[model samples]
Target: MNTRLQTQTAEKGPVSVIAGPWPSYASFRSLPERERWVLYGSAKAYREALEDQGLIMAEGYDDFVRRVTRELEL
Candidate 1:
């Protein structure tokens, strides 16, 4: 990974995983504010890079999420 990416990921702190299944949005939202900001910042960085590379076209947060969802089939 890129040094900047690694730093950013680390700054976001650790993501705890529950053993059995993925957590819901509500559960995720319950995380500390700093954690949430780190997650959002990381995602924004990635989305900006994808846009720069022409891999994805997104105008803003909502658009970015929609485009990513469509691409990932989520």
Candidate 2:
């Protein structure tokens, strides 16, 4: 888990920590198309986070892409 983003039951927690520094999704999303794009352009992290769920299909997708790439090159 990201230490910066972690929560314990006793503490006030991560949501308050995050909302102050960054523009929350609700605010930025209402802007014009170019305005929204410009806000997203200065990104420090991806919009979607991939979690450590221990899922198997990620390896399957890697193998599939490599196989297709090799076939296309040949």
Candidate 3:
């Protein structure tokens, strides 16, 4: 848990349970720092480093990114 997951209030509602591992070094490293900062916390992205998995998003994307980056201390 690199960052504390926050409750969301987007159309999809609060945070979802990803129930899997976070991205791997090889997969996560492929993204430019700018892109990595924008993962939607999708189960696919969380487990496999793939973002925008075609489902409704949870938190506001910008908010999610900002919070995650702040917490990651990057």
Candidate 4:
């Protein structure tokens, strides 16, 4: 099975270390360093990653987007 191991970070801090099946790891790695931070994975994995970093999660969907946007900007 295809798999990828990736790390994503925001301006404020490290975001996550993600591991999962991903067919596009090669393409993803080819991206510029600045763009490599944009990783994709299951929502459950993402939520767990964020929580592992002690980030506060928003219960509402809109609020979650806003929170992520704001955090990434930091």
TM-score of each: 0.41, 0.28, 0.31, 0.27
Tens digit per residue, CA lDDT, model 2, 2-73: 223433334433331121132344445556767655544433123222222211122243453454333333
- Write one digit per residue (lDDT tens) for candidate 3, span 1-74: 52334456566575543423333333454566656556434423553342344233335456555655554444
- Compared with the true structure, all predictions reach lDDT values of 0.45, 0.36, 0.45, 0.45
**Candidate 2 Cα deviation (angstroms), residue 10:** 32
What range of 10 consecutive residues in model 3 has the weakest lDDT sum? 47-56
lDDT of 1 by residue, 9-61 (tens): 35445332212221123434556766665665666687567546433231455
Error of 3 at 28 (Å): 14
lDDT of 2: 0.36
Off by over 4 Å in 3: 1-51
Q: What are the runs in model 4 whose C-alpha is more than 4 Å off?
A: 1-58
How many residue pairs clash (N, CA or C atoms closer than 3 angstroms) in each of the candidate models, in the order given?
0, 0, 0, 0
Model 2: runs farther than 4 Å from truth? 1-23, 45-74
Order of the predicted models by TM-score, top scorer first: 1, 3, 2, 4
Give the poorly placed runs of model 1, Cα more than 4 Å off: 1-27, 58-74
The RMSD (Cα, Å) of candidate 3 is 8.9
TM-score of candidate 2 to 2 decimals: 0.28
TM for candidate 1 is 0.41
* Higher-TM-score candidate of 1 and 3: 1
Evaluate model 4: give its lDDT. Answer: 0.45
